[model samples]
Target: MIKTENVSMRFGGLTAVSDLNIQISKNEIVGLIGPNGAGKTTAFNTITGVYKPTEGKVIFKGEDVTGAKPHKITERGIARTFQNIRLWKDMDVLENVLVACHLRMNVGVFAATLHLPGYRAKEKKSREFAMSLLDSVGLADLAHEPATSLPYGKQRRLEIVRALATEPSLLLLDEPAAGMNPQESLELMEFIGKIRDQYDLTILLIEHHMQVVMGVCSRMYVLDYGVTIAHGTPDEIRRNPKVIEAYLGVD
Candidate 1:
């Protein structure tokens, strides 16, 4: 569903990602794993248009989408969640999700001002769909609560839910397990799989948590110092000397 060919991102004298190539097939979950400075998030930023790569192409569904604006990418069936939790603290959980759905809502200012039948209908449907998404993620009862009131794990889940509100065919999750406990991470692994199955999504994620990466990803790619070190199944990655050396600092 997504491919990056010879992609490189540079910042003045520094190269964050160099000649990176990754391929993700439909409905498969792929992992990008590496040490802290491995440029995983940089790769995501380039793919999502946050930073245009200095060289190479990002192709989505066979079309070159490199350098397209982030919203344009989202509109074209890609949605992403950041490594840090980003939410509307003042808004209710439902409201937060509703904001993303605005990209799909076709109501005009004139129709909204007149409360036209089509506008009202669409608004009602959007609400229903938003509630359904919250419910799917087990957040329905908190629909009226402020988004920031949720605990950390729920906040992470909510961020993912908000991304889903964009109705993406391909989902890019950046370090979804950043600050979770072991049990929470385990639940997150299950949650990721469940969402993939329920949403029929093709997933690509950058995760520092080896457990989550190995547990959820059908295939994995390892990077070191902004370069691809190894790519294979979890088992192969675990046994790879290069990956071990990168992570463990072994000779």
Candidate 2:
């Protein structure tokens, strides 16, 4: 559902990503993996409209979305979460997710301020929907907890729930397993798999954890110095010479 063609991005003299091309199909949990500075996140940023590519095009759902505004891209059914947790620091868990609900709700500012019947009804609907999204990600019990007060793993899971609240057709997850213990990461892998199937969503994930990628992703792409090196199943990725060289040092 997402495709990039000959994409490149540079920051000053450094090319963070170069000539990268990738295709992620609907309902596919595709993995984007690389060593540090290999430009996996850069590619994700470019595709998700966080950073427009310096060269080439990004297409989603068959239309050119190159350089589109982030919200417009989101409105077109793409949602993302960051490597670092980006929740509303002072808000409750449900409130953070309600922020995503703003996209689909038709309540106007004046109506909300006046507490008009339409606005009240819309907000009630949004609240119910957001709560359901939180429940789906296993955060129902923490709905009233302050977002900043959650543990690291729970905070990460909260971010996922917030992303899913956007009602996306394709979800881009940036290092979802980053900073979690083995058990926590395993639970996240299971949750991700269940939600992907249950929600019928496509996922493009950037994960440093081997187990998370192997456990959840159907296909994998390996990047080395911002170039595509391998694209195959997890087992094929494990045996590829270039992938080994990219992960392990080569003399």
Candidate 3:
């Protein structure tokens, strides 16, 4: 559903990503894996419009969206979670998700300011939809709890749920298993697959945990120092000399 052609990002004298190319088919889960400083997040930033690529094109569903604003890209059916959890500290779980649901609400500013009937109606619908999303993800009971009160794993899940509130077709997840134990990572792998099937989503995942990525992604691309070193199925990647050398230093 998304393709990047020769995409590169340069910061003054530094090139963070170079000639990166990747294509994800509909409803497919793909992995972007590399050691720290391999430019994996840089590639995601370019694709999500956080940073405009210095060269090449980012095509989503066949349309070029290389330099579009982040919100514009979100409006075009893409949503993303960051490497760090970014839930609003003061908001409850449901409220955090509600903030994202507002992206799709059609009420005018004047109507919202006045709390008109139409605005109220839309707000009701957004709440119902958001609640359903929480229910689906098993977070409904904790809806009114402060977002920061959730455990780290649930916080990660909440961030994904908030992104889902935007109703995206393509979801970019950055290190969803960052701080989890092995068992928690295993559960996260299951959760990722469950959400993909439940939401009919195409996912691009960046994960440092090899088990999670290998367990969930059918295909992956490995990068090193701003260059794509290999792209293939997990088995192929595991056996690839270039990938091995990138992740495990060679003497």
Candidate 4:
């Protein structure tokens, strides 16, 4: 569903990613794993157009979307959540998701302001869709509460829910297990599987938690200092000497 070819990102003199090539097929959950400073997030930024790559191309489906604006990429059916939870703290949970669904609405600003029939109908549908998403994640009871009022795990789940509201074909999750406890992380693994099947999504996630990656991803890539060191099935990655060196500081 997505491919990056020789993708590189440099911050002035510092090269954060170098000639990274990756391919993700439809309905696959692939993991990008590495030590801190490995440029996993930078690769994601390049793909999502947060920073135009210094070199190479990013292809989604069959289109070359290199350097496309993030919103344009999003509109083209890619959605992502950040490594750190980014929620509208002041907005209620349902409102937060409803805002994302507005990307699909087909109403003029004036018509929406005037509450025309089409606008009203679309608005009602958006609300129902958002609510159904929340309900699917067991957050329906908290729909009217402030987004920041939820516990840490729920807040993380809400971030994914908001991303889902965008109706994306591919979902990029940046460290979705970042701050979760063991139990929460385990639950997130199950949740990831559920959402992949439920949404028919192709998922690529950046995660530091080896257990989470091993448990959830069919294949994984290892990076160190912006270079692709190894990529294979979870068992292969586990036994790779380079991967051990990258994570364990073994000389």
Report lDDT per candidate.
0.94, 0.89, 0.95, 0.95
- Model 2 segments more than 4 A misplaced: none
- By lDDT, the best candidate is 4
RMSD of 3: 0.8
Q: Write the per-residue lDDT of candidate 3 for residues 72-160, one digit (tens) a residue.
A: 99999999998989999999999999999989997788999999999999999999999999998899999999999999999999999
For model 1, the local distance difference test gives 0.94
Taking the tens digit of each residue's C-alpha lDDT, what string does model 4 give over 1-251? 89999999999999999999999999999999999999999999999989899999999999999999999999999999999899988899999999999899967899999999999999999999999999999999999999999999999999999999999999999999998889999999899999999999999999999988899999999989999999999999999999998898884
What value does the lDDT take at residue 123 in candidate 2? Answer: 92
**Candidate 4 colliding pairs, count:** 0
Which segments of model 3 are wrong by more than 4 Å? none
Write the number of the candidate with greater lDDT, choosing between 1 and 4. Answer: 4
lDDT of 1 by residue, 103-218 (tens): 89977999979999998898899999999999999999999999999999999999999999999999999999999988999999899999999999999999988877898899
Ranking by lDDT: 4, 3, 1, 2
Candidate 4's error at 13, in angstroms?
0.8
Every model's TM-score? 0.98, 0.97, 0.98, 0.99
Worst lDDT 10-window in candidate 3: 207-216
Using TM-score as the measure, the top candidate is: 4
Off by over 4 Å in 1: none
- Using alpha carbons, what is the TM-score of model 1? 0.98
TM-score of decoy 3: 0.98
Cα deviation in Å at residue 102, candidate 4? 0.7
